[model samples]
Target chain A: MYWNADLECVPLEQRRELQLERLKSLVRRVYENVPHYQRVFREAGLRPDDILTLDDLAKLPFTTKDDLRRTYPFGLFATPLRNTVRVHASSGTTGKPTVVGYTRQDVDIWSEVMARTLTCAGVTQDDIIQIAYGYGLFTGGLGVHYGAEKLGATVIPVSVGNTKRQIMLMQDFGTTVLACTPSYALHLAEVLEESRVDRTRIRLRVGVFGAEPWTKQMGRELESKLNIVAIDIFGLSEIIGPGVASECLYNTGLHIFDDHFLPEVIDPVTGKQLPPGEEGELVITTLTKEAFPLIRYRTRDITKLYEEPCPCGRTHVRMSKILGRTDDMLIVRGVNVFPSQVESVLLEIGQTEPHYLLVVDRRGPLDQLEVWVEVSDKVFADEVRHLETLEKTIQRELESTLGIGVKVKLVEPKTIERSQGKAKRVVDKRDLYNRDK
Target chain B: MWVKQISVFLENKSGRLAAVTRLLADHGFNIRALSIADTSDFGILRLIVNDPAHANRVLKEAGFTVSETEVLAVEVPDRPGGLARVLDLLHQAGINIEYLYAFVSKAGENALVLMKVEDLQRAVDVLSAQGITIQGHDVVHQI
Candidate 1:
């Protein structure tokens, strides 16, 4: 077996000590094997022995996305290529792909973590889990697949697309657990409603969704539409896969596998770690990852961490859903704007879909914000004047919500490009320095 | 039987017109006649080009949103009364002229007046039966 399930039943204090011991040995192994970690450690003039306890982890040098970009492909892997069983990469839309490697042992650990996550979500051996995340290059599909199999549940590797067939399988095959991104799950619910399929007739009872940040309103909307309990599963390809953390039946916050992955919130600009309940960029350090052990890797995701014990009897650390990426912030006319803020406002409007594009450009000395919103056919008549009025309404709502005036452009339905993977929500065209020269 | 014209939306910004004209020059499309209708915000630049179809496609591919419409192209003698006779026929037919611009044909025997009429087919028939030639081309090559 990949994991000792008995560890879940063990005392929390004992698990921490065992994890610390394992982390120390893993740190020593990486120091000897990985050149990048060795140079980083040596540059800080720190030895592996200096990290005696988990608290001493702050002394280690932090890993940034720029570091990952610098070591593009397999430069960060601690193990040789022959030992790596699988390789997954993040969609490097801005640049090259950020690659991650997993050894056989690392894969086993990942499966165990995912299994624990699914079990906490109440998925059992009797359930048929449909994995709907896109497979290949992206880690969501295969990550959830292994976890469901590890839980002794029948795994249906129904990689994303063909929504009609997906729903048919759910109805015919008696699928109980659905794994997909939250946006796609909502899209499927919309599709189900359109097809007039009786939502209650489906056997789906629970859903595990992640890979993108979704609001609580979205969760409630999906729950009402599908009549299934929606849970969040959080992970990145840089860290293990989609099962590194997951929400329990409580649905409050996602429980991190603190024994394997140490979570820290740090000021993104200063690199200073923050206390619990303080929102900042999340930093993660691997405790037992053998192939690619990262120490204090800056995730750029903004969220708060809490260590309070959950009602589910797990003492793992809980992290709120990510608010937004620090890099995704847009400066419109000297006022900072986040796309998530726009999304929240759109959700409040209750008529627009989550699809929106932030078009930023400079008009003379002032920055212009044009929000291209896709309107459904039912809500909008096919007339230019009506669209203009609707646009004004959206603009007014956004101004009140964000405290910044913005122009809204109501686009036709299906105008925005549907992304098969990560969605590109922002397009900024203002470059004053380049323009002046 | 057919006449084509190009209408370009020009923003009130520096070098905007130069960019559009330069693109046409590079593509070897010659401007037969052009007119500009302007407001404070933007200008509608209408053109009677040597080749409208090719010009429209080229301008569109270069990221300019371009559309086409039919206009009456009347061949009037290079004299005053020849122009007055065709306008009289259109007036008698109750076809309103929104706006128009005239260009001297390269042959110089006749002048071509591009007319934006309320009814295109009726104007074409009215001018043709009155013994005035309607200069509509299927294809006009670059000069």
Candidate 2:
């Protein structure tokens, strides 16, 4: 299933040698052309020449997302604006969008990695890929589109929305590969069930789902409902969009294309690199990016890395499923909540459906968290005391699990919105839009 | 005798109870007796209506989580110790009362106490054996 056999299975020593060369050249180029890198390097009392070996990468200043924001549109471009063939930006919900540029070669590298991503998911030229990731400013749709096209697969550029039409296209085109966020995949499966579309008619065999972290329970649910192997693809717009790494058919871990991008795990608190198999924030350094070369870019996504050789025979290092992001962690009354924690609890309870929404608000001086969960129809039909008992059980389990008091609201099925794209799990109306406010 | 009761889950919001009552009213449901059990976060509106099935279906269709429960409706004297005497009989029989609420009948003479117990059949049989007035559905509707 390897797309580029020679590059994907390159010998470890040869890969490291290639990485070192690319890293050195990237540093030198950024130092000469990008003013931000130059200033940061000088402030850190370092030079591009100091990074002779891979170990000296520690001496290079780490680039936070705030650095990218400060740089804005073209401040970090290693090449001139004319040489840049394309530009992409992150879906900036809060403030300014973090922009990135891609030269002609950068697009080629992105396409190559995407080809490898789809190939790892067992997609081929014969398969039709329906990319449901939203197109336009968001990179997901085009990222997967380029790779699927590069893989010689039939690309159905059916971006997000129009759920019924997507299903119809799946049946009409005999789509074999689905590319979208995992949440959208679940929503599509639900729509498929409601529409009474014959699942067997659509020849979907694999789903490349990413852009958000999803649970293994969700993966199983998708597999059973859609009758497809749901694969996780990880990427960020700043790095190169949806082709950074992908889980192979083995479904073990996401194998980072280390030759293209060097990956490291570091303790988010201390900003020190962690040993393999330690859970920490992911930091990436672009090894061969031309338009936007980043050095030790703090990913903020929390996960561990494994160096053990995978059965899939890809020599690249594999990262564990993204646990949660440091920024995505919600602190309620001093208790931290990752939406995945509530999701895991709901999955563990099993009596209720997996769909839930966490609504956090402030009442007077105390922060309140309410979990609106959809129970099974049978369970909802039971006695009110039983429903109350279920609520108490969930509250007790959550309080014990999250170490904070929570209120549980038993909602009817399908009351929570089914996201056409990434599911919005939390609605915090604490009114602290700004600290000064 | 067992009376069909409908319990609707209401979030502890300002207008939630009003909304449910309005929905029932719009559908022409005559609420015979009602009691609310509440906590800080939510309230359960336990209701006795003219048509339990119809009320439950309409409320459920309106997206309210409603469930049907069976409870005993007993005719307690309007005077003091009338309710206490029934409680004493139940206490002697070891029938644990989960909850109970009363409302004056149309005659404004006898008070009808709607009661829920852990063992419905046992509570009914124990009370009936002592010649207590247990109202059936027909009598409850007329009242």
Candidate 3:
């Protein structure tokens, strides 16, 4: 029922003690090794010996992706390049990709946490797993691959793309588990439906979907469409790869491996930590990462964290699926809008496709929010007024959800670009306010 | 009693309307009557083709958003008051016409008025009881 049951189900007090010890060592290591943390610590007037308990973690300066970028390649890595065994990076859309290094020990810990994640999703070593996440600099493919391997499962490393072959191997290999982003999973479902393969022949039972913020509605859509229980596995390259937390079969909350990674929720506006159950940006502190140990790194993902006894009996704290990321939030006419909120509204309306693009443009002084939604066959009406009413309905729902008026445009099906990795849901054309400055 | 109207969604762009008609023409479809209801950004090309099922299937296969609706095709008097008389009767009967278009029948000066109503059966009954000629499904091809 458990992988590494002792650590997976460690008692709360014992886990806290272990975390404190690891935190102290990590703080000392960073202060002595990385000059960035050294300067940050000196600027904050702090010493490694001052971190006597977990609460002292708040005293440390927060790290961000920008900090990683400033460091560029291997700048923030605690250990020397000789000690690091491997490295993986995120594909930053604009700037340099955020780099993450793993020593031999760090790689082992990633596998350990990911193995627990798969186990939490009800994956057994006997199950044959198919990993479709792209395999290069991205952490998703190798991350899940090594974990599935560590779990002693038969792995079919069919990295992303080539939908026909993915489905063919999915059937031929009798893959019991499917791992990829939720958007890719939807694409698979569409192609699989058109392929007309015999569904009874494929042994697909569970899906591990992640790498982007997806609504529960999409999860339900995939579940009913694929006839498999879809699980959301959360991770970022800056932290560890796709195993920071995983949703159990209970579908309640994702059990965060808090013993190895300490998580704190802080108000994105004030940067003050919020108590449990209050949704805020997540900040993570790696307790066991050797090559790159971050102190209170701001994750920018908004979610509520809960510390309670899960029904599955895993002692780790649970976090809800990310509601939205602060980086993805749009400020339109003094109102904050998240694309996930728009997605939820569209899915709830039910006839439109889950894919949508939010275009924000400034036509004079006001920021105009325009949403492009794909009109599914079920929603297309024969009359002009029929479609106009649909547009108005979507506009009203989006207005009520986002607390601001928005223009809704119904586009034809398959018009919006389908992404193979993280789906691009926004196009901001508004010029920067400070550019003139 | 009823006629099938193929309504296609088209972007408000030049050559898009041509594209739809050309595709239908390539497939040997005869568009008997058509009206385009357009806005600033898009338009709905409502067509009354000789073969609506074939037209709809063809348009959809060509990646055009197509929808099928049941509209009543009535044979109206060719005079100036011909169409208004039928409309007056429908308005008096409390039957709302969501939209309507007309085309002069080739067989006579009389025109065929295609009216799309929310209640197909109610509109047909109201018009029939008032002595109006509601054309059959094959009326588009014949007239």
Which candidate wins on TM-score? 1
lDDT of 2 by residue, A1-437 (tens): 78999989988888888888998999999999999999989999888889888888878888887788677778889999999988977633223567899999999999999999999998999998999987876788888998888999999999987888999999999999999876668778887887877767989889998876667777888898889999998998878988999999997789999999899999999888899999889999998899999999998788889998889899999998887676655646423466777877776777888888999875543468999987554566434567788888888877766656798987655668999987878887654221110
Residue-level lDDT of model 3, residues A31-113, one tens digit each, is 99999999999999999999999899889899987798789889999988999999997643222456899999999999999
RMSD of 3: 17.4
For candidate 1, write residues A283-333 as lDDT tens digits: 988888988888888777788888777777777888888766767766453
Is model 2 an incorrect, acceptable, medium or high docking prediction?
incorrect
* TM-scores for candidates 1 onward, in order: 0.64, 0.61, 0.60
The per-prediction i-RMS, to one decimal, reads: 8.9, 3.3, 1.4
Q: What are the lDDT scores of the predictions, listed in order?
A: 0.77, 0.82, 0.84
Query: To one decimal place, how large is model 2's interface RMSD in Å?
Result: 3.3
Superior by lDDT: candidate 1 or candidate 2: 2
Q: Please give, for residues B1-143, the per-residue lDDT of candidate 2 as tens digits.
A: 68888987766778888989999999998888999887665667888889889998998888887788888888777888988989999999998998998754543567889898889888888888887778877777556
Q: Report fnat, model 2.
A: 0.19
10 residues in a row with least lDDT, candidate 3 chain B:
B102-111
TM-score of model 1 relative to the true fold? 0.64
Off by over 4 Å in 1: A1-6, A9-12, A329-437, B1-143
Clashes of 1: 0
Q: Each predicted complex: what DockQ?
A: 0.05, 0.15, 0.30
